[model samples]
Target: MSDTPQSFENFKLNKQLLLAINEAGYEKPTPIQAQALPLALAGHDLLGIAQTGTGKTAAYLLPLLFKLKYAQGKHPRGLVLAPTRELVLQITDEVNRFAKYTDLRSVSLYGGVGPKSQIEALQEGVDLIISTPGRFLDLYNRGEIFTRDLKTMVMDEADKMLDMGFMPQIRSTLEVIPVKRQNMLFSATFSGRVEVLSQEFLEFPERVEVTPQATTAETIRQVKYAVPNLKTKIHLLEFLLRQQELKRVIVFTKSRKNAEAVSNYLGRRDLGEVKVIHANKGQNTRIHSMDLFKAGDVRILVATDVAARGLDITEVSHVINFDVPLIYDDYVHRIGRTGRAEKDGEAITFVNPAEAYHFDKIEGIIRMQVVELSLPEGVEVPPTPFVEKQEYEREIDLQKRKENPDFKGAFHEKKGNPGTNPFKPTEKKRGNKNSKAKKNRSQLKTQSKYKNK
Candidate 1:
C-alpha cells in the first residue's frame, strides 16, 4: 500500500470500501484529502490546516480506517478527540459509514448523556473511540477504560478545543497517551496558541495547508445588515424571509437564551415553522429538531455556535445571523451549513453598532469585503442610539456618586464620624435611625440575592 493520487481508481482501496465511497457519490479526493491521505496512510504524523466544508473529515478518516484495518489490533488502535458532542457524533457518523465494509467497531462518547452504553461499548472492545475531552477523561480516570492500545490520536478542531479552555483536559489526556504513535491535528484556523500546542504534540509532522486559514466558503454569498435593535431585526427578518422566499433557514445566535428568544419571536410573528437547538435542550430534543429541519418539516432553526459546526444538512437557502459570532471562524462554520454541494446559498449577518469591531476582523480574515445589503424601501428603521444612552440620567447619577463626598446610598453618610454629626439628634433617636438603616440595607441585600437566584 503506497501513496494514492486524487483519482479514485488509482487509490486501490478495498473494493467494498471504494464502493461505499462511490455510493456516497464522491469521485475525487478533496485538496486536504489528496495531499494528506498518502502521508497518513504511510503512518506519518500530520498537521492539516484547512477551512470547514473542505472535506476535512474524510481527509483523516479514510486513511485512519485503512490503517486500522491493516494494523491488526485486538484492542482499540485509534482515538479521536473532538471539542463538542455534535462534532464527535458527526465524526463518528463519517467513520462508521466509511468503515461499513470493514470489521472495525467504533463508539462515540460525550457528555449530556448517560455513559452506561459507552461503558458497555468499551467492554465489547471497540477498535476506534471518538470522544469529547471531558467524558473521555472521566471514563479514563475511573479505571473503566484504558489507553494503552491507542496508536493513532487525532485532535479535531484543535484551535476551537483550546479556545474553549480545554487545555488542562487535553493536557491530562495527552500526558497519558503513548508518545511514539501517529498524531494528527486538524482545525479551521492556525493561531499562535494552536501552533504551540501542535509543536508540543507532533514530532516532525508533515504540514498540509489546503485553503487559507479562517477563509469563509467562496460558494456562499456573504452579506451584512445594519439594524438598530431587536424590533428592527424582527421586521427585517420577516421581510427578507418573505422576499427571498426562504424554504429552509438556519439562524445563528451567540447564546442559548438568544436562540430561544429568536425562535419564539419568529413563531409569534406567524412564521410557518421554527425550532431551536442548544446545549440546554436534551439530546433527543436536539436530534428531533435537526431531523425536522433537515426533512423540511421546519422552515427555520435557530442555534448557538455549538451547533454551527458539523451540521451536514443541505438545501439550506439562507443562514441568517441573528447575532454576529464572537469568533470569526465560527462565522465561517455557521455559514457553511448552507450552500453545500455546488448549491448557491446566501449568508446574511445583522451587524448592530456594538458588533462592528468584530466584523472588521472577520472581513480581514475572509480577504473579501462583505457586501453591505441595504434595508428594503421605506422600512422606517432607526439606528442604534448608543451616544444618547451614555449621556442619560444613569450616567449623571453614577458621576454624582463618584464626585460627591457626602453622598451615601440615599441615607446616612460615612463621613467624619457618627458620634459627632452635623445634624445631631437624641442618642436614642440616632441609634434607632442607624438600626433602621442597617435593617433596610440587610433586607435590600437579601432581596437582591433572592432575585438573582
Candidate 2:
C-alpha cells in the first residue's frame, strides 16, 4: 500500500487476467483497486470500505482469480456472499469476465427463483460460487453445495447484509466453510455488528478505506424540492421528466406501492418506456426490466430500495427520489446509481414536510446541503390532502419519538396550551370532510420546489 501500482502489470497478474483487463479497456487501477489489489495478492484477509462504482469488485476479483487460475475441481474453490440477488448476479458477471480466458466457471445462487437450475450448474462443475447468504445456506442445507475446496471467501455489501438481517445465516456459513481460508469484507459503511464480525472472523484483516463512509461522489450534483403532498410531487416529477436533460433516469420510491403507482402514472403519459422492479416482482421479470434499461430500451426505471444497492447501470443521467428515503444511508446509495465512472450526474429528491426531518438527518451524514430550487411556472400543484397530512404528522411524531424517548408528540396536550390536541389545522384549509371534498382543487402550495438540469 506504500505507492499504488501505477499499472495493473505492477501486480504481476497472470497473463490471462492481463489480457482480459486489457480487452475490457482497464489500464490503470482505481483508488480502491490501487489500495486493495496488492494486499489481496499478498494473501491478506481484506476489509475494504468502498462505495459502489469504485471498482471494488475487481479489486478482490483479480487476486482471487489469480489464486484460482483455472477450474480444477467439481466443488467451488472461491465463494462470495452478497446481500441481494442483483449483487450476486453482478459479481458473477465480473468473475466470468476476468476468468474468461482461463477455464474458470461460476454460478449464481439467490431466492425468488427455483434451485433446480442452480443445482444443475453446480453439478456441472464450477470454480467459483457467488450467492446471497440465505440461498447459499438453503442449498448447503439441501446438500447441494460443497465448500470444502473453498480457498477464499468474500462478503460484499456487508452493510446491506446487516441491514437485511443476514447475520444469522452468515454465522452459520462461518461454521461450515473451511477453517483455512482468506476472508474479505467490502462495504460502503461498517455498522457495529459488521465490525464485530470482521474482528471475530476476518483475523486481523488489512483494512482499506478509499473514502469517508456515506460520502457521495463529487460527480453528482444534488437538489431537493420541498412540496406539500404526494399528488403535487407527482406533478413536479412529470414536468421534470419531460425535459430533454433527463435521458436515463432511475426513480427511487419508499414503497412497492409507490413504485407501481409511479410506473403506472408514467406509462399512461408521454414519458418514455417505464418499468418497475420490487421484491414482489418475479425474478425473471426483474431481470428482464434491468436488461431493458441497460440496453436503452426502457428510459425510466422505477424502484424501491431493493434496486438501490448493487445495480451497476452506467451512464444514468439522473436519480429522482419520488419519496425521501426513511433510512438515511439509502439516500447515498440511491444517488450512487448515477455519477459512475467519473461522469457528471444529478440527484433530485422530493421532500414532503413530514420527511424534512429525515432529509435533515441525511444532510448531516453527507455533510452538505442539497440545493433548494424554486418550483417551475405553469405546473399545477394541489394542496395537501387531509388524510395525507394526517399521515405526515403521524410520521413526523414517530420520528421525534425515535430521536428522543421522552418526546411529547404534537397530538399530546401541551402544558401552556389548554387544549385536548394542539395540532388542529386551520378551519379554512381543513373544513368538514364533506365540504373539503366538494371544493375545486386548483393547485399545490409549497415553500420551495426544481432545477432545469
Winning model by lDDT: 2
**RMSD after CA superposition, every candidate:** 10.1, 12.5
What is the TM-score of each predicted model, taking all chains together? Answer: 0.82, 0.90
Residue-level lDDT tens digits of model 1 in 20-126: 79888787887788888878888888999987777888888887787787434445789999998888988987886888788788889999989998898888878
Model 2 residue 283 CA deviation (Å) reads 0.2
Question: Which window of ten consecutive residues has the lowest lDDT sum in model 1?
Answer: 388-397
TM-score of model 2 relative to the true fold? 0.90
- What is the C-alpha local distance difference test score of candidate 2? 0.89
Q: After superposition, how far is residue 77 of candidate 2 from its true place, in Å?
A: 0.6
Question: Per-residue CA lDDT of candidate 2, range 301-397, in tens?
Answer: 9999999988887779999999989788888889999998788999999989888998999999988988998878967888888788888888888
Q: Which residue pairs clash in candidate 1? A: none
